[model samples]
Target: MSVVNNLVDIRALAALVPDGAKLVVAKDESGVAMAATRELVRRGVRNLHLVTVPVSGLQADVLIGAGCVATVESSGITLSEFGTGPCFTRAIKAGSIRMKDATCPAIYAGLQAAQKGLPFMPLRGIIGSDLLKHRDDWRVIDNPFGTDDKIVAIAAIGPDVALFHAPLADRFGNVFIGRQRELMLLAHASRKTLVTVEQVVEGNLLDDDARSGATIPALYIEAIAHAPKGMWPLGYGDAYPIDAAWMRAYVQMARTAEGFESVVAQWLAGDGALKPLVGAGLGELAGAAA
Candidate 1:
C-alpha cells in the first residue's frame, strides 16, 4: 500500500506532541524514544500526562526533571541497574506530578480495554495488591459466572499519542517493531503513534516475509523520523547495548536539581542534540538519533 511519506525530522515529530496531551511511552527494551524526547524538552513542552507501558527508566526521569509532565501513571519508574530515578523520586516527594500507581498486568489490561473500546478490563493479579487499594479506579467486582470470585476492574487507558523508537522504517513508513508487540497495542490504543528509528531502509518492511511478522503497518503510525541511535544510552532490541558510561554519568548528575539543569543544558546545547542527517537517498539516508 502507498503512504504519504510519514518521514519527518525529530523536531516536527515532537511538534505533533503538544502540551497537556496524554502521551504514552515504551519501556527501554521496547525501544525508548530518547532522541525525540530530547526534542520535546528543547521545545519546552509542558503538562504532559506520561504513561509508561508497564515501567520506565531514564526517559521518565528526564521528562519529570524537565517539568514537562504533570502526571505519570506507571507500574514503577527506576533507572534499573543505575538505581533510583532521582528526578521521578523528587517529583513524587514534592507532589509536582500526580502519580498513579499500577501493576504491569493492570496497565496492559487497561490498554487492552481501551483497544477494545471497553470501559474497564477485569484483572486478577491486582485484586489483593496494594495498588488496587491505592487506585480507586480499580474496583473489586464479583465474578459474573462464578460464586464469590472477585476481580479488579481496571479503568481503560487511552493516550493522545504513543511515542517510541525502533530499529528501522522503510520509505513507505512501516516500522520494524520485531517482537515488541506492546508497541502495536500502544499504537492501537492511542489517538496517534509517532516513531523514531535508527535508520530508514530502501523498501517497505511489510513486503519482506521475515520482517513482515514483526512490522507495524503505516496506517497505525502517524509519522516516523529517521534517527540513528535514537535509543542511545539505552539498548534497542538486539542491535546495541545500553551505554553504561553515560548511564553512570546521568545517575550522578541527576541527583540534584542544579546538576540536572546542567545536564539538560549540555544536552540541548548539542552534547546530545540532533545533528544534520547524514548521507542521502534510500540506500544511504541515515543519521545520528540526536
Candidate 2:
C-alpha cells in the first residue's frame, strides 16, 4: 500500500492539533516531544483533555500553565528529580482545570481497552485503594468464571490524538519507539497519532531487522515532524542524557506564577528558538537498534 508522506513543518504540525481535543502524550523521561509542545502553546490550543500515560513531567506542567489544557488525567505530574510540577499543582488548587487522578496500571488498562476496541479492561490493581473511590468509571466485580477473586474494570481511554517524540522515523512514516512500548498502546488507542523524530531514515523500518519489533507502522501515524533534541531536559532512553542543570533552573523558575510566565516567555521568545539546541548526537542513533 502507498503511504502519504505526513511529514510537516513544526508550525504546520501544531496546526493539526485542534482546540478542545482529547489528547494523550507519552510519559515522562521518554518521548516527551517538547518542541511540538511549545508550538502548541504558541498557537494557544485550548481546553484540551490531556491524558498522560502513567506519569508526566514538563510537558503536562507547561501545557497547563499556558492555559492550553482544560482537564488532565494521569497517575501523577512531577518534574522527577527537579521536584513537583508547580503549574499542574497551581491549576488544580485554583480550580482552573479538571483533574482525573489515575494509577499507572489502570491508565495502561484503559488505553489497552481502546487499543483492543473493547468496552472495558479488567485490571488486577487499584481495587483496594482510594484511587477507585474517585473514579466512577471503575467498578469492582466478582470473577464471573466461578472463582472467588475480584477484578477491577476500567473504562477505555480513547483520545482524539496521541503525541510523542521518537528516536527516528523512516520516509515511510514508521517510527522507532524502541522499547517504550507504551507509545504503541497510545498510538493504537488514539484516533490519530502525531510524531516528532530526531531524523528520518530511508527504507522501510519494518523491513529492517533491528527495528521491526520496536516500530509503530506508518498506518497508525497521522503526521510527522522533524525535531532534533526534541526531548531535551528529559531523558530519551539513552539517545541522550537529560539536561539536569537546565531542568533545575526550570524548577526554580516555575515555582511561582510570575516565574513560570517568565519561563514561558523566554522559551517562546526569539521567534522559534524555543526548540533546544542541545543533543546534536541523535543522528548517531539513526539506524542503530534500541
Candidate 3:
C-alpha cells in the first residue's frame, strides 16, 4: 500500500513497530530477517511470534530474549532424527517462550484464514498433541462431522507489521527474493510488510522473467529499505553465510536480560561489528559477523 525505497536506519524501522504487537519473523540465514527481529526487540516489542519453516540456531537465540512464542512449521521427524539445536529447548527451560511443532502448511492455513478475514481454520493434524495445550491463542473446537478427531481452530495471524530483507528491490517496492519462496510467504501473510534490500534496481529491470522469477509484486508491499547485511547472524543464501561466532555470542548475551540490553546498547551506539555490513548491502556484509 505504501512503498518507500531508501536507506533507512534499522532503528527507524524498529520505531515503526509498537510495544505488545504480534510479530512474525522469518528464521532464516538472511541478514534482514535477523536484523528485523533484533530491531523489534530493541523497540520494546513483546508478545512476539516467530515463524520459521524450520527454526534456525540464531533465531532461537533471538526468540529467547524477545520473549517470543515460537511456531515451528517443520516436521518433528527431521529435528528428532537430526537434532535441532538447544535454542528452543533452552528458552523453554528459562521460561522465555513456548514452542509448537507443526508444518508450514499449518502456518499457511492459519495465515490464509486470517487474510481471508475468517475467524479460524479447522486443522486435523494438531488434535491430541501438546501443541493444543500450549496454544491458548487458538481455540479448539469439535469437528462434529462423523468420526474424526477434534480439530484445532487455528486463528488467523494478522500481524500489525512484517519486516524482511531480500537480495534486491525497486524504489517502487517490488522485491526479488531469488530462490527463497518461504520468505516470500512471510511477506504475503503479514498485514503491512516492510522490506530491506541489498540494492534498488530500475523498476523495468525486473520485467525479465529470469530476474523476476522470485519477485513479489509491489502492490502488497508497504515500504522498501536498502539495508545490506540486514540479516546478520542469519545467512543470505549465496550472498553471505551465517557468522557462527556472532550467533554464539548473541546466544550467550541473550541468556540474561541485562546481557540482551547490552547487545542492544551496542547496536544503538553504532559500535556493533555488524554495522558496517549494513552499508555494503547484503552480499558485502555477508558472513562478516564476529
Candidate 4:
C-alpha cells in the first residue's frame, strides 16, 4: 500500500496544533500523546481550551502548569493514586483558568452531537444536578414524546483538533486503537485529528479482518508521527506499565509554586533528573529486563 502524505516527524506533528486552539485529548489510560505534549510546552502554545474526554492526569496537569491552557473542561483531573494535580489545584484556587465542570456522559453526548452535526444532545444524568445551574450550555427540557420526563440537552462540542497516541498506525494513516472506541468519536467529531504512534506498520491495516474493525480510517486523520513509547510515564494499553514512581516524584517535586516550572524544564532537557528513580516496581522491572 502506498503511504499518504499524512506521515510526519514529531515536531511537525506538534506544529499542527495552533496557539489558543480548542484541543481535545483522551484520558490517561487512553493514549495521552505525552511526547507531542512536551513539544507543545516547549513551543509555548498558549490559551488552549482543553477538553479531556472524561478525566486526565499528567498531560493535562503539565499543560496547565506550563500556562499552555486558558480553560479546562472535564469531569475531573487527578494523578490517579498519586493524589491531586497540584498545578490544576493552584490554577483553580488562583482563578487563572476558566472551568467547565462536566459529566462523562454529557461530554460523550456533546461529541456525538458534533459528529452528527446536531445542535445538542439530550442527557438524563445531569438533569437535576447543580451542574445545570453552573453550565449554561446544558439546558433542561421536557420530553416532547412523554408528559413530565425531564432531560438536559448538551451543546455540541466542535473542537478545532483532537490528538492522541496509539499502539500502531499504518503508513496509510489508519490508526489501530484496539478497544478504545472514544478515539474514533474524537476523530469524527473534531475538525482535525492528529496521532502519534508507537510504530507505523507496513502495508494496509484495513486489509486484515482482525485489524480493520479497530482501525480509524485515514479520512478522519490529519497527520500521524512515529513516536515509540509515546505514552511514557503513563502505560500504553498493556504494551507497557505505568511509571507510578516517576509520577509520584513529579507530584513531590512540584509541590511549590516554582517547583512545577522546574520539573517541566528539567524533564524537557532530558537530563535524567526525573527518570523514575524509585528503584522499585515499574522502573526496577524495566531496568532488570534491560
Badly placed stretches (over 4 Å) of model 2 are 1-3, 270-290
| lDDT agreement of model 4 with the native | 0.87
Locate the minimum summed-lDDT window of 10 residues in model 2.
281-290
How accurate locally, in lDDT, is each candidate?
0.86, 0.85, 0.59, 0.87
* Per-candidate TM-score against the hidden true structure: 0.91, 0.90, 0.71, 0.93
Which tens-of-lDDT digit does each residue in 1-290 have in candidate 4?
Answer: 56788999998999999998999999987789999998999899999999999888889999999999999999999997899999999899999999999999989998999999999999877766898899989999998899989888899999999999988998788999988889999999999999999998888999989989999999999999998888887888778888776778789867765566556766676524363324244434334433
User: Which residue pairs does candidate 2 place in steric collision?
Assistant: none
- RMSD per model, one decimal: 7.3, 7.6, 7.2, 5.1
The digit string of per-residue lDDT tens for model 1 on 1-290 reads: 67567899999999999899999999988889999999999999999999999999999999999999999999899999899999999999999999998889889998999999999999886655677667877999998989989878888998999999988899887899888889989988998999999988887788899999889888889999988888877876678888777788778878888667666765665545322222222222112222
Q: How do these models rank on TM-score, best leading? A: 4, 1, 2, 3
Q: Best-fitting candidate, measured by TM-score?
A: 4
In candidate 4, stretches whose alpha carbon ends up further than 4 angstroms from where it belongs are 271-290
Model 4 collision count: 0
lDDT of 3 by residue, 1-290 (tens): 34445445666766766655555555454334556666665565666555543344555455554555444333231122224444455565765565566555566667777667887777767666766676665666777885655677787766666667788887656888877676666666777677777777765435778877688777667766667777765567777766665555555554455555455555544425533222243332333432
Considering summed lDDT, which 10 consecutive residues are worst modelled in model 3? 73-82
Q: Candidate 1 at residue 231, lDDT?
A: 85
Top-lDDT structure, candidate number: 4
